[model samples]
Target: MANYQEHAFTHSGLLADIPVTLLAKPADLTAMISRFGNLGDAIDACEYWYGPYPYDRVGYVLTTDGALEIPTNVAYPQFMTTQTTGNNRGLYTHELGHHWWGDKVTPYVHNDMWLKEGPAEYSGHLIEEWIGGQAGLLQAVKDNHFRVLREAHLDDGGFQPLSPMPDEHIYGTHTYYKGASVMHNLRGYLGDELFRQGMRGVQIALAEQTMTPQQFRDSLESATGVDLDAFFDAWVFAPGYSVFVVRERTVNAVNDSFEVVLNIDQKLRGTTVYHEAVPLEVSFLNAEGEEFLADIVASGANALHTVMVPFEPALVVLNRHNRLNQARTANERTLIPGVSFGSTQPFVDMIMYQTNLVDTTLVRIEHIWSGAGVDPATPDVIDVSDTHYWDIGGLWPEGTILRGRFTYAGATADNLDNALVDGDETGMLMVHRETPLDPWAPYPDQTVLAGDLANGNGIVNLDVMRKGQYAFAKSSVNVGMAEVRTDLATVDLFPVPAMDHVNVQLDGGLNGTVRFDVLNAAGQLQMRTFRSANAEGRYRLDVADLAPGAYLLHTAIGEGTAVVARPFTVTR
Candidate 1:
């Protein structure tokens, strides 16, 4: 209205002509043009996928209130008119996309915000894919897939369904990112030509009219000629994503070919699995640097499937192209010390942190499965009722301590292949062991913290300074006396028989120097050593140097609580 500079640009549209112009302050004109430099490309790409622009004219208007899409006219904030690159172009395309998704084709109800914003956000991907090709689209979808997996459940306002969404979170992460993700995965599911036809039908046939979730589903079903009720019910109407675990993967070399059998299980969240309908891409890489892929389809429940390939594969990976929103970060990476680490498969809320030492370490976390690759040996104590396992590994420095707060399902358990026995949450114990050879024991210092238990959920805190292999079991144990420690605490140790190693069971809340001395029967000290520790874990003492005889183990912690002495025999 006052001193606004104008730059006019023109482009030919598929059906309607687009006379594009950029209007901004004199000082901001160059940056604005740079930001909207791809306006013509956006127009052509949108038309190529979504038909006409749906408006008689379109222009970029700079205003105090920017970043909103009006009918045929686009609003841009002067300050936000930065140069477009990488993903920045998406914003411009999204706002312009609203011309097709919302400005013309409106939502019948507020809950249908996904019908408007989802496609509009997806328009950016379409334009990106249209101009940059399939590689760009794959990258875009992968980014969204990982992002949704990382954030969909913990979004700002918390978890909510895409349809009939809570009024407050109508525009939350699930609506925009997950909605766009659904569209991307749907395109992959229904194939390009058919998916495009279905999408264009929604814009062209339902033009200038209001739409609902049901109406959108009907339009797509009519175009694709495929039933989508289960897909919509599981992905849109529900609150969680599909969780998959490679229960077991075995490769055997046949005559010039390889036979690969994948025992896969569909673990649930709040939603059910749709693996039967949706195709999961599995990639197999041979030692000759060649990669082959196969379409993996299974029931929503657990199953064992087999595939035959021409070449013996060295590695096998699933969902290589990022087709679903899942909680499994199958890839293993190092964890930094003192940093809070969570976001694991199956147990999303399980948190582990190292507090005793401050240095880089080789702690890596990977997938949690029914029985990916853990030994199934049981000791004298056996209670395998509804137990789920998640294993991670890293070396613990001399006295470093690692603590974890385990979060489990409450009632309608949605984790592993089988349900918790009786679906009861009480008496739930989270146990850990060093390896398949080691006996399962309550974490060195274990505490069953109060949690929502009656439903099928509970929490337990434990300090573990050892390599991985943790599980949740539905068994009754004296929670206080669940772990077996050597008779190194008191002069008379009865509950847990003493072993060679000095058991250091310290609570997760304490950090102190643990001192233990082996004294002869004459009250003369034979050997003494100390180690700094925190959380709850144990370490082995070298008794191989001592002569065979009986001795007293004097254990002490901090300043005041240094009064424990236990008698033990060193039979080296």
Candidate 2:
């Protein structure tokens, strides 16, 4: 009950020359607090970005549990209680931001909790990014995006609107992470200088008073002098993301000019479809391979447009900056030599998500196609590498399917880490089509696979993945099967492509103690359990909530000897 010593001390510091105190439990937190010093640097950073700190004295109460903001004093989790634990400076910065956000300028109504959490969250992100540069900011944003998507995935159906969200989902991703993400998106929409000016205006307008979503929007409009009603409607009030389907595009070279025709549709799923007001950037490379950029606003159904160019356009690129949270990422359509990879007609679309970090590169290749050939355990017909993220724009008379593959070379481990196609959450890695006549309903199981990622390889198959459909995938922790060494090798895991529940039976039971653990591809622990060896050595595990993907099963005996590990997959 008492392996560690717990003491308390009050350390005085200064932020902007204001008397600040950091009271830590276990006394050991003194070093961490001292190292981090006063909140001066963080406060200065925020002031430079956001406005001035509105509080008199900033004091932090460090406890081993819980975090809450209380006017002049704030309580934070004691993550800095031990030297072994890295200082949670991020958490400290985030809570500190609440003094200006949650306390000073609160939301007019509880429904608009985003005003508090979003600004605070974004502040911490901004501070860290300023200190650590682009990589840090990118990682922060990526983590935020992942959190939002994860929460959305776990949601009963999917993401709800940020504004007027159901009470149950009020504190969910839509309000916190998505709220911050939308702010970042706005920054992208409005150039940095303009966005910064608008932000300053918001802080000044809503200082020391509760504000509503409309009031906040009005502040931004007042500062930027640009109509943001559409922006707020699409990103804030709307419940779903934008889905742009390239119905058709034609490029013709006249005597002295080139004409381009584009037909796009914004047919999105969910109860509310976001009518985004974003610039569509189309790039054309002349015969000399020089690129020219053109911007336009294409909205509504079947947006037909014509572009005139003075030179011959060899290749065209659309939506280069990825300004939209597109349901489908594939924007270019291309020819794949002799491979019949796409649909006969443009029946499917590919949405790819890629991220590169130190020692890890993740690419999520997803195909949205329709047809009868769709099966759950769809074999890899096209290599993912062969497919491009371009919606070729109806260029092919006989369209083809897309394919690609991923290899683990120089990776830290062989395990394909946290990898999953959000659209195919079952980890089936098969083509998922929309329900016939019902966009909200699930498409019938085209085919059932034997297990989750049967071979443990980063391979994908979208057989009969029709044209003009939508699909998405992401790089989850990609990892391979972990190697296991044990005398009791007769462990049996059945229902390869497991559903509902998985059964485990061992021929040779451990005589001592036994434990079990499940890990996702990213090597993150998912589940843990303790089991006593019985006469039959049978274990039935429920897996209804586990997303579809490759997972590792670890069995440990007394003191870790005679340990065994196996790989298994899950499908919805």
Candidate 3:
């Protein structure tokens, strides 16, 4: 039997452990421990800012069905798992953060849900960053952005006032992503330490009590010792995102640096003017691979400023992380090589996956290409001449390989001509000829005449294709294969730089059973496995327990066997 009573004990500020009952089985003991540990970490994080844990005898229960329920005495979860992926851990962390931000410092009503939901959501993200790192945090933000953009209806007018409850369908947008975005903006405005202090103050003020959003705001102001009305008005109540465009840039020969200006535009669309300090990151890379970074702030629309940074950069990129949606003159450029026959299938697949589809009465085929990193001089080089969509030329950078498949109508030979390249145009295009599939391959005389579009003659149809059908593009590129050197020889692990979890696809090569171990930068082991004659397949290993820091996965197949090591990360 497991010590269920001890695991359920809630620690007060003074470290007093109260006896409690365990409402789970022995197999669930590990999960119970993890939950308690998370709860303890949340308590510590909150206390580091506020004061200390204010409650006693806190109970955590796992509910088989329904959403999470957080009461003053207990937290009942609708789901619990140690699988390391999905929203389960995040949801758990957010609910635990509510112990400090909502349950303790209660939000008076549902209208001011931001007070309860925003901080909690922000806390979950913070915890994710702690365990998953920068990539994980950025991915979480991206997921939130995508979710809100897909579900929320901006035309319904800017965010609904924090008083009336909006429809639950909009919950993911209004209460989660938008709310978290506001908190994130506020954190940027007040700085990390000050913002944390403000959070602590709010918790202390509402200890064992309830407060309105205004009261919480007042507490934050008092704690941070700064005014935040503008911050609140712009983020908490605003709709849509701020757009920043790179207007112009100039290089200074004397200093061997560049001066760039950014134009911030606001599309309020009849909404109140948003006034909040926005931080922007600018990056410039020179021909020699040298890079320089500069940070700037924009307080409102039409805010223009110039900053001089070291290095006569060949390319300048803004918002490198895509943190904000903006139209910039100097967006990142990509090289797309002209496509021809005998090109690598993976390369063709990549082009097809990236290209947008243009359909007309002429033909129907998939088009894949990338616009990012396109050379500005040749902004519209991939022109479709004599074609219905002549204006459909895509942006391509120098040295980029372009690959795609084209099927010509069997009866009508299409004239697919390659346009001549000029000084302004410097990229290759490779087009593959695909035969129409036979409805009955083994059956004789079972073929169909597929329509095709030729040079300036037949109609052409270009449709955006989905991914996964093509092979890995970079594999066949001249970029050279990635060097795989390992001190260990007997074990092999693939799919390096994986997202969620690392799969230990063991092959016991020559050596019998292998021992797999994953260690962090601090030389701390995260996971260990002992396999016997393992096949060449995926073996899931959870890395969510490990912090965002770097880690090494070492596999020892057998005696006199080689040890293979790989680096992997867990992204939320």
Q: Which candidate achieves the best lDDT against the true structure?
A: 1
Candidate 3: residue 419 lDDT (0-100): 26
What is the per-residue lDDT of model 1 for residues 434-527, given as tens digits with 9 covering 90 to 100?
6544656544354443333344544555544456667765444212222224433423332223345445454344455554555667654454
What TM value does model 3 have?
Answer: 0.53
TM-score of each: 0.62, 0.55, 0.53
All-Cα superposition RMSD per candidate: 11.3, 16.6, 21.6
For candidate 3, what is the lDDT? 0.46
Q: Output the lDDT of residue 52, model 3.
A: 57
Error of 2 at 118 (Å): 1.8
- What lDDT is reached at residue 378 by model 3? 20
Write one digit per residue (lDDT tens) for candidate 2, span 261-334.
Answer: 76766655343554756656776666444667777676664477788877777555555444444443332333
Best-to-worst lDDT order: 1, 2, 3
TM-score of 2: 0.55
lDDT (Cα, 0-100) at 541 in candidate 1? 56
Candidate 2 deviant stretches above 4 angstroms: 1-21, 34-45, 80-89, 156-158, 245-247, 252-261, 267-269, 274-276, 280-294, 305-572
